[model samples]
Target chain A: MKLRESVIDKSIVQNFLVDAVRKFSPYCPGDLSMATPLIRTGIVDSLTIMEVTKYIESCINTSLPVAKINRESFRTLEALSDMLFDFIKEHNLDLDIDGLKGMG
Target chain B: MDNLGQVLERSINLYPDDVALICSGEQVTYAQLGERVAQFASYFSGLGLNKGDSVAIASFKSIDVVSVMQAALRVDLVYVSLDPRFPPERLKELIRDAAVSVVVLDEFLSQEWSKLEFLPDCIQYALTLHDEKKLEIKSDVKCHNFKEINSDSNDYKRFVPQRKGEDLAYLLYTSGSTGKPKGVRITHDNALAFVEWAASEFEFSQDEHFLNHAQLSFDLSVLDLYNAFLAGARVTLLPEDDAMFFSYVVNLIRDDQITNLYMVPSGIIGLMDKGALMKEAMPKLKRILFAGEKFPVTRLKALLDWVEPNQEVYNLYGPIETNVCTFSKIKTDIVFRSECPIGEAISNAQVALRQDNGIISYDGEGEIVVSGRCVSPGYLNSPILNKSKFFLQDNHRWYCTGDYGYFDKNKVLWLKGRKDNLIKIRGYRIELDEIESHVQDTELVDDVVAVFHGSNSESGAIVLWCVFNQQALDSYGSIDIVVNLIRQKLKSVLPHFMLPKLIKSVKELPKTNRGKVDRLKLKERGI
Candidate 1:
């Protein structure tokens, strides 16, 4: 199934962060936030980043350009949501950009 | 000292006309190679070279380099094959670290080394000819024609006879989390054990022609060179240039009928991208071994679809410290999956999951530890690393692989990811902390995190997440510029195998509550 931003909102990403932190990392969901760090706090790793990239790509139904594959684009749930929205808009991509924007 | 020479002598006496080495347009037979190795040993002894000394062989991957390595073994000396592309500073450092007394360089690389600060400890330098019409050896260093040194009498005494199992064979230095590279010491017994297992597993034979494309410093070469020799198989060394090497492999497969080929994921990807390897050209390839990195199961399926279904495709996984201890031989009927199974340990090896307390036999998801004859002696001169990594249990020296993996109830080993701050590129181990160190060394860089955005090894790309002091982008010119400087500096010290393919600078590096760089946060931020 194609991945859509509406289907995989900041909550889905946040949930992934929660599960990742609990499973692979030492950090527990003391207080999850949009700006909470996932990797530095030992909640995620570089290998996890590959899985996240794949998850985001499948949800959006388009390739994520290398330029957008960095920390700022992945800073937080809000940051990732906005970046996906912008990515969908820039390529005239196949997604609901306005809906994604409002959700962000 | 005479053990290697005696083996070659015996092989030559039995199979004089058997093919020894296959280069682009040259193929040397066993008898001729035996004479050449013996002649060089005589020349070295004539110059008063003794056992336990180090010799530096600087050249690209070619038949000459293989001959030099065998000759070094004949004399019971550890040979460090310095990558020709290494800057003089790195080369000199390795030469000094290994305490090399002699050097044999290709004519082209010799010109580059001539410009370096020649150490007082080195006694002689010989220049090996690449093309015909050899150039004169350098005047500053006691020079010998490496190729023509074989003209000496074949009646020669072997220099060292006590080539024990504990004798040091080679030194392969890898990037450490700390700045300096750490040498992994491989002994003769450990190397021979791995080679013996590999030779039997591949069913290598005197009739099979094996391709040796990996660099000498890589552990894969141990399987390629020594394993092939153990089976009396002809080894065709692939050149270093990408295009030339790929084209050459195609021709070698078609012309030489190479029966066995082992390569990194990227190497196979390049061939598949060019569509250069046709079924007709690779008909004799009984086995295609991929190791050092994972090949996507989809790509492996495509390759299998391209060739005969019965042609074995094996995915091998082993930390270099353990000499490729576990391997998964893909079945033709098995459908492809995204996650490749690393398979079970080799016959002589045992793999177990160790807890934080170092006890073995955790059920799921723990640090992978290997114990066998295949395991390395330890990191050279790093007692601290030895204390942390090498442990004794049940009268066996166990190597902490630092990789996270678990075994299914069926005993199939599945690798998860590394527990350390490192990544494997083309089978060469690189510490991610090493890259962060370079990034942090840049001007106005407060903190940084290097993340592996590329999922598979074939892609060979990484994106760096950076946080700067007041948008230092203008000073560094661009993110690529800062990356280029790091590459330039690293290239001088580390080989190309360690360089990152891409870089991305961000306003801030995402950090966890602990204040360390948060890699998952960087992923979420899309940095």
Candidate 2:
């Protein structure tokens, strides 16, 4: 019943996160950094968060537990990607890096 | 008893010590709220404002703004709610169109107000709330601070004017297809009908803590504000900044123990995405109502699973022209085929489907025609719009809702789509909403919007813009894979001609100010 951890490329995950932020966050500045606070800076509202979360789940192929969708997890692009990576590691799910690029 | 002012007065008399409103950490009892309303009324009277005159209020949602609105109602003045977020030019246009004689606004908006080049000739004075210091205005209009007016001991009993049922209560300006905002004139009776029906339908009581989520300018606030007063229920106003934050909103609801909640589908989806319902049980939350736009079935199912078993959910349907005319209760037993039904008409409204042949149909598709006490008088000062939108047929004044729908076998009304949104692609009639609903049903997609490009002739093509679900993207591992999956799913339900000519994957769809999908913007992008 146990699932094996799937190998994921960190660069691919970072690239996907960048694309999601650029497409979903309309008000987001062009030079948005990985450490930027999307909600606090008004770059993204609740709707954008939903879209971003959905995009993340699709890339990783897993449903995020309610507990992982807090403010800390969604603080920035780095934080969100790290959380997804952690989820992938914990659940032992496989990541498809080439497939992730097509999504981006 | 015919207007909101009377409702507030009744609530004060019935529950003087009960909390009437909580805004920005300030809780006001019914008695205190009444006194402040009276004080504002007296101040307005001192400034020579008379019955039937328009008073424009441009401020954030707060206790002072609520008091000013009630004060205008008490003095029989037409209160015009203006969104302060609007640019100066748009605000000036609305103020000019409303022919407002006075304006009550927050000091924070002083800079923007001063930038306005044109001021309505009727606007003689401006009252600034929140700041004790006087504001320096560049115009000839006189400005007064709230402290100066509130401290006056003048009796307000004599200032209360007798208002008829047909008298103008408020003017709400909504964006029209013509790219201009048209004000909708709602009368005392027009609002009272909806308020009265909602109070009884929801079975609201004095202890009900209702959440005011919509902006004051939006007509949805009519239900949030007046319905609570009609039943002597406490209203908890969500500030504009905090309303944008999902976690903050959930915390507010849990902390305040809000009993009744009203919001648009997008707001509800945001809460669901952030695990608002799953994190903790909102035990005090009794009724959750959504309106303004359609709620995707997948999201609604998630919400239903998250809430308590006994809690009630409703899908209310109506345009700004008529305050909620039809409502559908989201019962646990009812099965949703695609979208939730708009249900039956309210107590004071009648809904009928009018076919293309100018006849009413019970079980087929047609434009929803609403006739009854809740229908508004018509658009303010727009005779052309009034003539086209409002008509008298068979001795009944009916407002033609541009939305298309039909009554099911069980007599429940189901909205199909907007009449204007229907497109003819290569001589094939296609409903944009129908395509969207089918695409949304796909497990791989989170949201979908179908728009038509080009003329109605054979040259036109349909474009399907979709946002893929994270889980699906993860499983498929590529955008091409997700798109292929969606195309395959859509192929079974749609014909070859009805299939999308171009499928574009987007991160998110643009939304209008009222929170509905911004199709006009999508078309403008020519994607």
Candidate 3:
């Protein structure tokens, strides 16, 4: 049996995450790097995280599993996007890149 | 007898060993808490602070903070709760307004004290709550550590000053519509009436572990702290950092077996959105009380379905001027018309609706006016506001609540909107809340805010800002699609004049410090 290789576009995921953060947290200053801590830097607290997660789930067309809905998965833009990509690959869900680009 | 200090003293005598406070992984029994208050009271007496004096507390919620508050009341001093989150300038403004002589602050905020402009002249003594560092004191101010104060011997006879029900107990500053914070003067009687009613209505007992999630500065915390202490129940103060993370708060609730919770609607909504309540069956949660803002019926229903069927839920309503004058037990079989009705007045309060013609009505919509012991003594040092908001009618003092509501035939109060929220467009008056209610009722939206833009004339237009739910967003891929759906939905339900001219989709609605929608900020962002 041969294992299938996974092909993920990092830029697409980064763009989506950045746009979502900006939309949810309009008061967040300057640019948010992929490694920037969302909670530590006060970009999103418990209240605003709800909006960010909801937007991500809507874009991905999948609800995050109960276990994945936690601080670890949402610590940073990179962490969240990586989790989303992993979930997509595990579930073998189709990603409509064009649709997401237009939405962002 | 109506003094808050007497209530604490009675609880200490009745339940000495019972846990009174739980914070920072430590428990303080009623006996220990009482002792701490006594030591602090004795120390204040040594400093010549007596009845009617003001003590400002600028710190996070903790056992020490509550002890100091109780001690101030014990010594007949008015305790002022200030938010540590505020800047030094704002704190100075409040301290000057209250004429605070002594300030108790957390050690973490000691550095910010240097930035204060009025502290040099206004503050006579500074007591640090946490750290024991021999620190620099500016303005020749006397500073004391918390440990030393608590360990100080009460060898000298301490005089507990006599106080009346009308004596000021606390001063809480609330943001006003006029761009300044107004201090609401609450007397011993004003708080006692509400606390007494809550203890009876909620059936508070020592077995209940209540969660204190509100900031110490917010009036909602007043109910949580006093009601728990008065009933000899354990109050678990959720740390400031823990409150910012939903999972942490959920874990704390589960670990502590928190039986009672009092929060604003936004706090409850945030927990619900994180699927906190849905994750497990909180059998220990006996009751959940939400106040300070409107509870959307959809979210309330979701919460009811998530929690245990037998658990009680209450929707309370009151401004800071009159702390929680009305409450409604959200019955399982209850139906909502637009939003949840704020319900009837509490036992100690009387609710009346007055029309524009100065006539009180029972069944029609009018301004909500509350009377009785729950009403505060009026705004502190704000005579213009006092003259307008507080009134004497039939030998009774009534507070104009600024909220418009009507009493249904069932004697229940249904809130319409704020009186100032009324907007005139093209010579027609429209309630902004009514439009927002219709928008929230639409299946596509989770929350909605309707704001009037431009001058209140023929040129003024109504703008509707909405946040679509996950389902709606997933179904409709773009903002244009969501806007079109909402516009169509509103067109069918609203009249031509009530229809919103602009439909905007926001990721989230801006919220005020009290967690209500910041309508002022929305208005500033014109159409």
Q: Per-residue alpha-carbon lDDT of model 2 for A38-102, expressed as tens digits?
A: 55544555556667777777655777775677667777888878887778887877655444356
DockQ of each: 0.02, 0.14, 0.21
lDDT of 2 at B316: 92
The list of candidate 2 runs beyond 4 A from truth reads: A1-45, A48-104, B150-158, B421-527
lDDT of 2 at A51: 70
> What C-alpha RMSD does candidate 2 show over the true interface residues after superposing them?
12.9
User: If both were scored by DockQ, which would come out higher, candidate 1 or candidate 3?
Assistant: 3
Report the C-alpha lDDT of model 2 over B1-527, residue by residue, as the tens digit.
77657888888878889999999889998889888888888788777766899999988789989999999988889999986655455677788888998888786676557666667777788888977678667778899888876556434354555885888899987654443467899999899989889988999887789999888987778888888987889999987656766766787788889888898876777666553655374779988998877777877887887677768999998988898999999986679978888999999998898889888656778999998889999998899989998888778888998899988889999988776765533222345676677677776788888887763323346788888899988887998988766766654444344556678888999999999888778778786
Provide the lDDT at B333 for model 1: 69
Best by TM-score: 1
A best-first ranking of the candidates according to their TM-score comes to 1, 3, 2
TM-score of chain A of each: 0.59, 0.78, 0.78
What does candidate 1's lDDT look like per residue over A72-103, in tens digits? 65555567657766666566555422223232
C-alpha TM-score for every candidate: 0.76, 0.72, 0.74
In order, the Cα lDDT scores of the candidates are 0.67, 0.77, 0.76
Q: Could you tell me the TM-score of candidate 2?
A: 0.72
Write candidate 3's Cα lDDT for B154-256 as tens digits.
3212435588699998998865544345789999999999999998899888788999988787787877888888888889988655675666677777778
Candidate 3 displacement at residue B1 in angstroms: 2.8
